[model samples]
Target chain A: MTGRDGGAPLEPLGNTPVVILVRPQMAENIGTTARAMANGGLFHLRLVSPRDGWPQDRAWRTASGADRILEAATVHESVDDAIADLHHVYATCPRPRHIVKTVMTARGGAAELRAATERGLKVGLMFGPERAGLDNEDMARADALIRYPLNPTFMSLNLAQAVMIMAYEWWMAADATPPRTLMTNETHVATKGELENFVSHLVRELDGCGFLRNEQKRPGMVRNLRHFFTRGEVTEQELRTLHGVVRELAHPRRAED
Target chain B: MTGRDGGAPLEPLGNTPVVILVRPQMAENIGTTARAMANGGLFHLRLVSPRDGWPQDRAWRTASGADRILEAATVHESVDDAIADLHHVYATCPRPRHIVKTVMTARGGAAELRAATERGLKVGLMFGPERAGLDNEDMARADALIRYPLNPTFMSLNLAQAVMIMAYEWWMAADATPPRTLMTNETHVATKGELENFVSHLVRELDGCGFLRNEQKRPGMVRNLRHFFTRGEVTEQELRTLHGVVRELAHPRRAED
Candidate 1:
């Protein structure tokens, strides 16, 4: 696939895990799921008895240019046939089942999948339908369960979002680039000296305006003020902007427009 | 909202971090974003100059019972008014803007937001429109940039997925329970005594089979075998199952069936 900005050809999305959607209901959701998978670099999508049937127009409409996934999707009759050839299988389940199975967070599961792929093992990640997640029989077929650490009170996740989370984790684990770096391209971070100078100037102006009342409590107040600014990790440019803001706010307006 | 299982009433979804969508273009996307936020226990939805305008029927249709988010949503004419009172503001930006700012991954930004909430600071997470992301002026207003570690080639993410990621991280960080844990509800972790007994039984069975043929490496071989099973923190029932497997394998020719 070409990049969104028409850059170099895009690397294949998730290649290791064959994402099997069991009895997915909504075509739009299936489409979104495909898009999510593509976003995470996951390609192979298998469906098991979709409620609305495959080749739905809405799925393509919602897929938003990721129809390649849908077009290449394989439909299956049962979960057994879906993962019959896979060496490692993970069921994305939220509730506990009757059987005993290894459970892993998405991160741990991705790491385990990576190891399996390195050993030339085909892995499948199964997701149940949106209405009720994987049934007991479906859960029983998997080696382990992968559950997102969601708020217990509100454990429901949009199916595509769930797929996206797993895909994102897998992509992040595979990609070697740092997730983010401090935006230090244009200017340097403010030094302690610069921060202190700005804080001292503000304190002096505040004191002149009687903002720092009670001389005995002045030092503690100043320390608290300094702590607030320091916690923000003010950059040199931001500090200058803050100085300008302070100067404007501190000065009295003498009928100046 | 009641859970899918109709158990307990859900606590209010996101109350701390206000989600502000700037110049949103689509109603369905807005709806799904609401649903995603609700899935992550976030309810506060703020819209800044929505293109299709608020109270669209399509948004409600796609929200999937997350209309509460829309009903209580506050719409503003501008981003500044939307986040006027927030102490901490994070901009979810996929592309770099021509400005100097602090950059953090979604996980790091969530941690920072969690800390700010601990200090009773109100936080606002701003996301730009679908076509064009936040402009330089909008980025300038934010305290930090929350970047998702996405595939460089296919960097575009459906806006709701982005929101869901942040919400999931926030919920996980706030929740005290570990992300993934062994399914230990029915059985306790096998005690050392039980583990030792199983190990001894397994070793005896292996010895009878002449598996440890090399006398020089016998100790290391046994140690390696022990480490393999023990690493999983095998439960009592699992140990029993292993024992059954060993017994069946040891007497292969005596199959009664």
Candidate 2:
């Protein structure tokens, strides 16, 4: 029961899995958790009885620039109300206590959440308090448990770190490893012919300068030199620079000067 | 030089890449970096001139039981001195300023560093100061760069979280990552320094030729030019080819003949 929202109820952030912090104590941790969620592109935040109570001044300060997530967060009276509308729920727990649920690694849980999001299901990712993790009663509410593969000897993950890692997994599970795109949008990628021309231009200079004078190694050196430019998949702007670079080195600012 | 540890130098903890924080600011951040390293099984920690000074009471307190790592951590006067014993190095830079190095995703980088480690190479994973990240000069020392695939819209990872995720990926890399390259190759890939030298040489020639004469726009143009070359992942042989190409074009048979 969110007491403040008047007659209407707060809704889950569409498609994205909701992050629920149950009885989290410190404002700093909550703020950092919200920041972590934003980093992983998860927006919805639901708090179940934060110990320091709601709208803590310090919380917003700790959240860095993630003010929007904290601003839209809904407070819940209980865990049951927190996940009331969710089609699926995942509780993050270290493996030893995962006897009751269909235990999955964080990676496995991320894939499950990704699938649920694609199917348009309302999903909840629950994290317990800073002092004590989810109680047995609270853990029982989840459909499955996410056991992060942490070091067995030093299993010391803070509340924000756990949420951050889980959120990272969620983002990574859905994301295709992006093909390396040239960061600048201004220039078009160079054509194969453009690259060949640049390579040929440089080779011609090498020949003239006697840099490629060794007959035994000339062809191999030429091929290797060509491969370097070809692999960059140079942009038109870069190729232009290269062409100019060759011309200038052979005959410095001869025209512009 | 670690002033406190007299006689023998503080050596890194075996084959794992020593986590080097370049001028990290706060005790809290340094403490958390150690904690994060512990969580992911990374043992070595090196501080490249921590601003607040070392052995701070607040750091160990904030580390939250990651005391052993903090205790054994070594402080260095410079980035080079910190990475002196390391055979391979990686710098993490997530944004548009990346230039003159092979760029890799955190996952991809973790696998690579892991391979280098398995081959008995001591490695270094470098992070920059909180307020300002690594300078281009500092970046020039690395074998390559590690760029985390963060949510592009909200890519605000703190110092400790950055180290944490990298450490997590390092541990995850042992079995989880697929092999790095699809093609068969023998010659070693060029290090960031080698790649950077080629970029600087070409840029100088471009400058001499007046290709980058637009003073107001030179910085961006230089960055773009470096990016074009860095993206290629040129090998040692290719780098040699490129050096010859640059030399031949600049001085030409006009000099050598």
Candidate 3:
């Protein structure tokens, strides 16, 4: 028993962006970040190369009731692997970068993420390490930048602060009851990992059939193909179908050896 | 030098709401709340009857660089004294009260507060103790209520989270995202894979127990079972618990394995 709904269990809010922290330092910040995310109604968390490593006891201690997010959190060795399953990704930085991408305020970025989730796209919001924030290399990979509009003179934002602002916006932008929620939840949309697997499978098939005969342009061709599919939302069943199609195309049924 | 504003003196942002913590328990949280407020560009802080009294070193130490806000913070003996000079007041509560008052989202409330201040009125946003939030008497005194659009099922908000949200909203003032609708559930819905895994586990256990021995009806029984659980929302933790249940039932341990 806890409060008015004393016996009720705590569950995370669904269909929000995947909050990815890139190279985060300090276990306490990660823990506090989880609490902030939970408060703002965000659930999914991905950590790319946490400095002290995952399963830290300090993080659990600080997370309070939000240890559930930490328990379900997935750890990635690289940013690419972290966002492989996502269709859209935005990076949160404190300052402007030289990249030619759309820069959005916290609310604007959150609205965009919410709209994408409603469209069935799995989106991610990435934050850089506490020290220097996101580098240009990481900035180049993101579709856009989410910059919090803090006071110009006193622009002091920690990891938890940045996450909570977006989280608040994400929660507010939602219609509370989404129209496509049931279908989206039921289909159990293919994760970026699943989609990536299918893409790699298709690329391998294309390579075997000489579809990209020009070696110099193969990487660009492959990139185009991946983007074409990555931009679309696919369900688990759809990925299975795509995998089957690629398998059949690569190995004809005429010789089932 | 911090970011691009190194070696520059920081000036407080103008026209933001006053933050009041009523009967706050921890001094460390008071410090962190000041930091959260500063991050969101709000500086005015008022404490009402702090549990351990004022001038807490723990609070100043935990405040990071935000001790300036704490230094300017004023302490009052009661809630009325805290908001005596405020022209408008909004209590941040997690739940709806029996008292009839306009319930505004955090953003909406912030916008309203900004408009009031712009009209040359003092405004205060009050938060209750960490244990049980604002009481009915305290809530009844406010001009309106500001409830965050958090997940209804897991609406566990702390003092710092509430302060940061109001501070962020008041600081932005330009956000146009419509506010005030809260999501229904707290439990995170299980992904398709997690659901499928649970179904497969249950079906396998049923087979082991000879529950699906009938040749013609086995598929129908499995279908019915899957549909029964699939029709409802089961969180990831719930699914894990279900998996454990099936495992235990299939091979019950006599107290221990």
Candidate 4:
């Protein structure tokens, strides 16, 4: 399936679960976070006692075509209520709390969450209130802590921005190896057989140039030359260029001779 | 200089030119754009005719600790007035206009701008009003246009998001390799020497097991074994595990035998 943006194909999330927000404050932030989630092809959203509003007009206005997310946002009274059905719950925190749970960086958390999701586990990502954020009591509900490494002094990230960062990382993990468009126009690297041919050609050129005066040492010298080129992993274009150089040396002009 | 948030040291601009937006429309957007610029350490914000507030109240609020940007904002009037002393001026546009000198992608434009900046040339990024963006007339003032690759259905992006994307690409260019911290922690593959040692051990174990009875084909067998391991790029940990298996095979326990 094509991504919403169409730059790449959408990666299917076989069983990845929703993101749960525990007491999000601003409607605009909710809207933006929803948009960010949509941008990364994450569809599920759950809100717990959002401060300003839920099913908010301002949120709908700011959602900017991500109304589908707003339409599907599940509302709950408390953090526990939001993640009651989840097999795994990850709470986002700036710093570590005294919790006996797996602690992962945002990237690591996303990766693990994605893996769990693929295995058909219901996962939830919990965010807290805008101003004060999640309390220790709220964090007690999580199975893991997702910590973002930011400047300690200025660690406050707007809700949507945080969502975007996590979502982007999840998207990247889904396609860990970036698809490389091969340079079809460029000469392909020579195979082992081609390298052997090039070595033989080079040896003949060296003999013609009187460089291999001693036949016994010629084999050793040729082996060393082959090792040098092999280590370089010379490309087809490079081998072609080397062939030209060898031809020139073997059949030199009278002036050079 | 320290960032306005007074956190980590800001990435140095070296000689990258600054793009000053005069009379920008939204403060939140300005903040977003500033964050974008900060992504690549693109210092020098010159503002003129800001809408919500000068020194950008909303901008700083949304900048997420990029206060140093607000501290460094330089206000200006007309487009020419903003970049009059600068050697190069790149204007951003959603579409190419016949009147503009040239139109380029944010990536292409950034590459050119970076080159010019590296040569100690002053470069300015011109952004027009939000609702109308840069008019063909206003865009004429710039040397080239920086266009973003967006969905054709909706080419528009909030000013800050657009800025952030460009800044991100520029930052990636500044460091061609991913951050060192981002490297995977997988075990190192065995080196040539290590592989040779493992192969010798494997051959001895196989001989002890009477697996290789024909000594005449030993050289070919060894070559084949080397090829197999070389193709796999066995890690040091994997080799150790393999060595244990080989030792077990060579010196079987009395019960197992």
Q: In model 4 chain A, which range of ten residues has the least summed lDDT?
A: A176-185
Candidates 1 and 4 compared by lDDT, better number: 1
As for candidate 2, its clashing pairs are A209-B252, A209-B253
TM-score of 1: 0.76
Residue-level lDDT of model 1, residues A1-257, one tens digit each, is: 11264354444543479999999988999988887887777888899999988789999998767777788899999999999999999988877655667788887788888888888899989998887888889988998899876656456676887788898888767765444466777778889999988998899888988989889999999999988997756688878888888888888466455
Q: Tens-digit lDDT track for model 3 on B192-234?
A: 9999999999999999999999989998998999889976456
What is candidate 2's CAPRI-style docking category based on DockQ?
incorrect
Query: Which parts of model 3 have CA positions greater than 4 angstroms off?
Result: A1-14, A176-257, B1-12, B174-257
Least well predicted 10-residue stretch by lDDT in candidate 3 chain B: B177-186
The candidate that wins on DockQ is 1
Encode model 2's per-residue lDDT on B70-139: one tens digit a residue.
9989999999899988998988876536343467777888888888999998888999888678888888
The RMSD of every model to the true structure, in order and in angstroms, is 5.6, 27.5, 29.0, 19.2
Residue-level lDDT of model 4, residues A1-257, one tens digit each, is 01133334223235555878777777888888876676556778998887766688888887767777788788888877888788988777665433344556665787888788888889888877776667888877887677654433334455776676566556555653322112213566578988887888988777877899998998888888877887734567767777888887677676585
Specify the CAPRI tier of model 3: incorrect
Query: What lDDT is obtained when candidate 2 is compared to the true structure?
Result: 0.78
lDDT: worst 10-residue window of model 2 chain B: B1-10
Best-first order by lDDT: 1, 2, 3, 4
Candidate 3 lDDT for residue A86: 95
Candidate 4 lDDT at B49 equals 69
Docking class of 1: acceptable
Q: Write the per-residue lDDT of candidate 4 for residues B130-162, one digit (tens) a residue.
A: 766776666667776676543333233556655
